[model samples]
Target chain A: MAKQERAIRTRRAILEAAGAVFDEHGYMSTTIAMVLERAEVTKGALYFHFASKEALARAVLDEQVPFGAVPPQPCKLQEIVDMTFVVGQRLLYNSLLRGSVRLAVDQETPSGIDHGAPFRQWAQALTRLLELARDRGELLPTVKPSETVELLVGSFTGIQLMSRALTDRADLADRLAVMWAHILPSIAVPGLLPGLDARADRGARVLASLEERAAS
Target chain B: MAKQERAIRTRRAILEAAGAVFDEHGYMSTTIAMVLERAEVTKGALYFHFASKEALARAVLDEQVPFGAVPPQPCKLQEIVDMTFVVGQRLLYNSLLRGSVRLAVDQETPSGIDHGAPFRQWAQALTRLLELARDRGELLPTVKPSETVELLVGSFTGIQLMSRALTDRADLADRLAVMWAHILPSIAVPGLLPGLDARADRGARVLASLEERAAS
Candidate 1:
């Protein structure tokens, strides 16, 4: 059991180190040697976990799409909004997610890496939630679920990219708040629009909730 | 005059070849030799115009922001919509524009090249037009020009990226049509919303008009 726990910890460390390198240098410029030096793992251990740099990047890319920690909101639209904020906040500190975004957005990988998976996954997640919101009458009557979700996903992607470029995402939550404010007028039902929590630190509350849940 | 024209033609050919290569291989993977071979120019001739691959890419990046070919419309919002479609059409066939977009969005640059310029230029252009839109009383009272323009530019950037990834951007105009449909109702007064020409072939007409004007 001790050995198994050690192996898991090593894997986590490697991923963290790889994520930092990949996020910083992007895919082609990053080397396994850098990851190893940062991770402080033996070459054999690194090889045991990942076959190639491509494989390692693909693994990091996969690690980012899961935002399981944000507690569910009563409104499906709020859940979607919370997910973007938590993600925006997380991108400020989470190397894994940051690397995943770099890979997803700007990195030109070899043909083997699936760049579209994250986009499709985000679309699917948002589409499912949008449909739920639609059914609950939380959406404006004219809000087409698929179209609205695409705008949200695409806008959020570019907003974060611009925020990252301009301010290192120090203003990501504020930018997201502005984004929700502009979009919600066209999306959420009139009553729900006033109640939507899209403040700058909403992500902090969500993360605190996650910590509380874990502690309990 | 003959010597000057020949030099101009050589520069155009080199830029085109470089743009195609950079768009396909991205910045880091692109080599000077590849550009020389594709441009069919001697290495000395290539270097005479562009000092390095980075210089060549920066030139391609600069070439993309010119939407001057798009004729202006009386309605500032219509002008913005028309410009996006024309750009969408141009991107399908223009290597320089495509390379510009690739450089602007992806690729690991050596920090000498400015990736944020295009985003800033786009934001500024759209902001100017949106304010004009407001002056004409064409916009909804709630539309905040800067916020709305940011959402538009960012959404357009990500929408084009997603379209390129999913369908090689064959459906870019259609995707953009849907985008304007989702956004205009929120931005434009009700009367202007129905008259917005966001069809896929709108770009073709704009191009055809440019051709006619040039011929005349």
Candidate 2:
């Protein structure tokens, strides 16, 4: 058990190190040596966890798939809004998520890695949520789940990218709030408009509640 | 006069070749030699036109700034929509714009190059247009031009990027139309909604008319 725990820790260290390097230098410029140097792990140990730089990037990409921070809400539309807001907050401080975004968008990444997988997964997850919202009569009759999912995903990506470029992602949550404000009125049922809270500070509130629940 | 014309032609050829190479290989990996080979120009001639690879990227970035295709509309909001649609059409075939976008977003770009200039210019231009819309009483009283410009620029970027990733940008105009459909209601005054055309075919129509005017 002790040996197994040590191995797990080493693997995590390597992943974190690789994510930092990939975040700073991007996929094409990141090297195995940099990860090893940053991780303070032996080459053998690093190789044991990830075979190549592509594997490291795949791991970072995978980390973005299971975004488990968004707690459930009574309002499905609000839940979707919460999910994006929490993600924007996470992106502000989370190295792995930041690196995953970089890898996903970087045009120089080699074709062998499936960079599109994360985006497709995000779309699927959001589509499923929208379907649930529709079933609950939360969405307007004119709203199509698939189309809304595409817009949400694409617009979220652009908001984050622009925020990163202009403010180093300091205002990602605010930008996402603006995005949802502009989009929700068109997609949500008119009745839901008065109840939805798409404020820039919503993520911080949700995150605080999540941490509180975890502590309890 | 003949020599000056030849110089201008050589400069244009070099810009085109560099744009193509940058679009394919991105900024960090692209080499001056590849651009020279593609342009079929001597090293001296290429240097005479562009001092460095960064200079070439800046030139491509500069090409994206002069977006003058949208004809005047009584409604300034519709004119803003038309500008994006025309740009979508241009992006469909314009290597310079495509390359400029890649360079502007790529994380590996060196610090010496001003990657954010194009985006800032775009935001400034859009802000000016939105101001016009506000002045003309086409925008809702609640809408702020600066914030709206940021959202428009960010969302348009996301829509274009998502189209590129998913469909190789084949459906960019369609996506832009969808974007406007969702956004216009939030920002434009209710009266203007009936007259605005946010159809996917608008780009094709705008492009056709531009070509016709140019030929005449």
Candidate 3:
């Protein structure tokens, strides 16, 4: 058990280091040696966890879909909104998410690896949430869950890309709020539109609450 | 006059060739030799027109902000919608626009050139149109032109990206139509919404009409 724990920690250190390097230099330019230097692990230890740079990139991409600790709200749409805020907060500080996004968008990455997996997973998760919202009559009858999922995912990617370019993603939460404000009114049932909290501060609040929960 | 005409033709040929090469290889991987070979122009001639690959990229970026021939519409918001459609149609065939977009997003490009210029110009153009929409009373009272400009540009970029990744942009017009549909209700005055035409076929029609007008 102790050996396994040590192995897990070592793997995490390597992944984090890889994420930082990938975020800085992009997937095509990032070298395993850089990751090793940052991770401070032996070549043998690094090889033990990841066989190649592609493997490391894949691992980084896999880590982007985080499992948030936020408890479910009565309104599944609120949960959906909260998910974006929480992810936006993480994206602002988490090298893993940032690296994954860069790798996913970078056209130079080897085509063999399925970089689309992370985007597909995000769309699927949102689809599931929207399904729940539909069941609860949160969505308007005209709103299609699949289409909404695509719009939300695509819009979020664009907003984040522009935010990254404009402000290094410092204003991601605010931009996402604007996106939600524009989108939610069209899809949400009239009664529910008034209650959805699509505010920039929600991200910071959600991050704080999650940290508090973790501490408790 | 003939020498000036030949020079104009040569410059255009070089630009087109460079755009095609950039579109295929991206800015970092593209070379002056590739463009020279494609353009069938002497190295001296290519250099005379564009000093470096960065200069070529800057030229490509500059060419992206086209002055549309579409005449004014009664509804400024409709004009804004029409602009996206016309651009989408152009993107379907224009290598210059494609290369410019790719270069703008590429992180490896030299930092001296303003990569943000195209996005900023697009936002400014949209801002101007929204301002006109406000004056025409086509916009909702709550719709701020600047904010709407950011949202529209960001959302259009995202939709185009997803369309490109998923379908090689075959469905770009349709996806854009979907985007405008979702956004228009929140920003367009309720009475104006019914008259707004946000259709997938609008791009081709707009392009065809523009060509006819030019020919006539």
Candidate 4:
């Protein structure tokens, strides 16, 4: 195998290992040796990819937003709904996303790390989509993109935390469904509510659709 | 002061100092000596009341809800709104409340602590009030007390965290106002929306009214 390919695989493995460790022990309690043991890599290999535990945590915290296409819908609201469910579903299986979320909301972060960046990023992403929905005349007249985005992002943060605390996020998709049901009334036009596919199984369906798209 | 009175005041002082320290450094990084220095009490005095740092943190985490009464409003929905805002406003001023909130949501808690207790307590508190609102016909016909309570508590959790991250909670009351405005349209009957005192200054007013009632 080419060295570049091998190096890329090793880096991914390290990040994956680091994410799980951070999620379990948090930043302050997590040690470099624990990450190295998990990754099954020597200290040299770990150092080559990252400088310290803080750097590793920084890298992990940056992976909350995964890059995969959710099949778009005619209604921008549907698209935003899919985006949130997809994330909700991903959090159930993805260590990197889980680690990032834990770090983002965790009271403790390593010095110099911008722990709040993910919240701001989620806010921006939701804002863009909400603005699109507004332009397409899908939103209610009282809908403010900025205010709703803050609520959406913040509520998502809190909803997921509650689900995790109560049920270990096994009900995250359902919780997201409940959130959308409560919020969509104030957000989307009354005409659009019945058609929006906000449901507990949305994340599973969205993921399956993505797989089908990839296979096709 | 009498011996019992002096002891009670000292205990309050130690808890207060420990709360601020925990708020600043989080659970793991906080040291007993740091709390002792802040409380301005001797190590022996501190130990006489609290056995360990975990014990001290547990004590602080128990104080998120302060024992002040918001004047009774005719609408139960109005009461819930005032409750959230009052906590929001207090979060900006009270060290014990602030520390409890931080510890409640912190990633790195000390060994053998129940960090999730506060979330459950908040959920139960809101659920009861929401149930009352439903019984009195203040809520919309379609409102589900169970579902709405989860969203309300969860959203408040996320909203305050967001406000704190974005503005150090300086705008928390206004954010709570925004939250209620959006949520009320769905939960409360249309007739009640026009009369609900869900505003930024609701907390200040509720607190001041409590003061006036005490004076009278």
Candidate 5:
């Protein structure tokens, strides 16, 4: 058990290191050497765990994304949006990881790699969450699950892309919050998503700062 | 005037070549030599036009984006969305330019670059258009210009990001039209964008093919 724990820790460290490097330089630019150096691990250990770079990249993406069963709890769709907003903002703000995200997002999938499964999984998650809201009678009957998912996911990426383009808007959290605050009501139950909590407000404020800078 | 026209032609050729090279090899990986080779222009000719690679990149971006003048015809906001969809689809379809776009989007702005002015200009353009729509009573008076601009810009990028992620969705033009069909009605005046045109329906068929492959 003790040995297993050490192995898990090492793997986590390596994953984190790879993620940081990938986020900074992008996958193509980031070399395995950097990950090893950052993790202070040997090439043998990395190869021992993951056989290839593609496998490692996939692992890093998997680990970074919360793709598995979302915590089953009493939360509104708005809360889910907020949760995603908070988590996504944290990931974006980390100076080391931000670049990697840009790289990952911008990097075209090599030929023959089907990204649909993962993409669908994300869409499904959002769809299911919306369904839950609808089931509770918290949403309008006219709101289609597919459309809502499309809007939420699409808009989120759109904002992120714009934010990425304009780097000074580091406080994307607040902007995201404001987006949800105003737009969520259009599709979801009013007040299902809590008001811009402190963290979300910070995101809004960050966006405001960027806006002010642009105006100036 | 004749000499100036020749210079402009050379500049246009260089911009086109730069975009092609960037699209194929990606921004970081593309070289001036590759661009010159593709453009079939001598180094002297290339230099006579663009001062440096960065300048070339700026020119390429500016040239690709129709930012110089707004369209002359009065079209509904929905029409704008549809036009943008077609433009985006055509741009991404060029495999050579696709790779470079990622790099351009992900490239870190050097200190003091102030890239936001361009983005602000885009937002202002959209805002002005939205105001026009409102004046013509094509949009709801309650619609907020800032939010609408954010949504418009964000959703467009979102579609691009999603299309890039799912490669089989080759009919990006069609999917965008369907998306517009679904979304425009929510915001635009009734009967403005009209139903999905034949072009958009064809796009839907293409998306179906990709979706089918993805599902299988």
Candidate 6:
């Protein structure tokens, strides 16, 4: 148990160090030497756990990104979309994923493949939520769930890139929420958007209730 | 007259050549020397035409992308929106402005004020079009024009980035047109979307007429 705990600590340290390096300088700019220096680990230790830089980046995408496993909730489609918006805000609210994304764009990679592969996972999460929305009759009958999923994810990514490049503004979350609000109304079944408005109202009420409790 | 013609020709040569170099090797990777070589122009001639690299780039934005200019026809707001859609399609359809936009994102000049200046121009162009649409009463009264403009342009840029990075496919223009068909109705006034649809049908008819004329 002690050995396992020590292993976990070292692994986390390596991930944190890698995150800092990847955020500061892009994937291409980052060197193994720098990762070793940052993590305070020997080169042998890095190699022991990961084979190459690309593999390490894959690990970073898999383990370090907070979207590893879906949490247990009521599993409502809107809830999933709301959760995605929250996570997107957390990750792209700053330069956390900028370097990696920029690197991915600049490199000549094969189509539909990612070395880091965070985007694929993001798309999968969106697809899952969209499927649920379809099942619930939340989406318009004419709308293709897959295309809608792509549009939502694509729009969010686009907004994040612009916000990052231009103002370094963290308001992308709020902007995305507003965008989704409008978009949901456009794509949802005729009466579902009213339900969303009620949901928002309830959310506001919950916040008020929490504050009241805290005050008491 | 001859002197003016020569000047125009020289300017076009420089713009075309600059675009090529910018596309082949990223904006940061290319230099004045490389541009001159690609254009086959003497340093004196290049400098005489464009005071600096940034000046030349600004000129490209002004000349190559005439997105802000008034449309050739004076029609309904929906027609104008459709016109803007076509403009986006033409601009990004063939990688013509792909390098320019990528440069816009990648280049961080020492002058902080000039940063994101290119993207600002893009947003301004869209804002102008949206304003025109609003003046014509084509857009829903509640729709925020600035935010909608930002969303549209931002989403287009994102699609371009994805298409360029992944598939090397330039068919994003068609996809964008399809997306607009679905999304335009959402923000448009109840009566206005049908006008857009009518104009699109008219566009098809016009194209068919042109083809018939050609065949005759």
TM-score of chain B taken alone, every candidate:
0.91, 0.94, 0.95, 0.91, 0.74, 0.75
Poorly placed runs, candidate 1 (over 4 Å): A1-3, A212-216
Task: List chain A TM-scores, every candidate, in order.
Answer: 0.92, 0.94, 0.96, 0.93, 0.76, 0.75
What DockQ do you compute for every candidate structure? 0.54, 0.75, 0.64, 0.68, 0.30, 0.36
> What clash pairs does model 4 have?
none
- In the range B50-153, model 1's lDDT, one tens digit per residue, is 99888998888777668535787898889988988898899889987888888887737655788777777887888988899999999989888988777777
Specify the poorest-scoring 10-residue window by lDDT in model 1 chain A.
A64-73
Q: How well is candidate 4 docked (DockQ)?
A: 0.68
Error of 5 at A31 (Å): 1.5
**RMSD (Cα, Å) of candidate 3?**
1.9
**Clashes, model 2:** 0
Better of 1 and 3 by TM-score: 3
The reply for model 4, stretches above 4 Å from the true place, is A1-4, A42-44, A67-69, B42-45, B67-69, B212-216
TM-score per model over all chains: 0.92, 0.94, 0.94, 0.92, 0.78, 0.79
Q: Regarding DockQ, does 1 or 4 come out ahead?
A: 4
Flag the better candidate by DockQ, 1 or 3: 3
Candidate 5 docking: what grade?
acceptable
lDDT of 6: 0.60
Instruction: Give the poorly placed runs of model 2, Cα more than 4 Å off.
Output: A1-8
Name the 10 consecutive residues with the lowest summed lDDT in model 5 chain A.
A64-73
Predicted candidate 6 versus true structure: per-residue lDDT over A51-167, tens digit per residue: 877766666655423532233334355565555454554454333344445444443222233632555566677677778877876777777766666566556657766766676
Candidate scoring better on TM-score of 3 and 6 = 3
- Residue B64 accuracy (lDDT) in model 1: 67
Model 5 agreement with the true structure over B3-81: per-residue lDDT tens digits: 9898887777777778777765665677899989888888999998888777776655544345223233466464456
Per-residue error for A9 in candidate 2, Å, reads 3.9
Off by over 4 Å in 6: A1-12, A57-65, A68-75, A92-96, A105-117, A197-216, B51-64, B67-88, B91-96, B107-115, B197-216
Candidate numbers sorted by lDDT from highest down: 2, 4, 3, 1, 5, 6
- Alpha carbon deviation, residue B8, candidate 2 (Å): 2.9
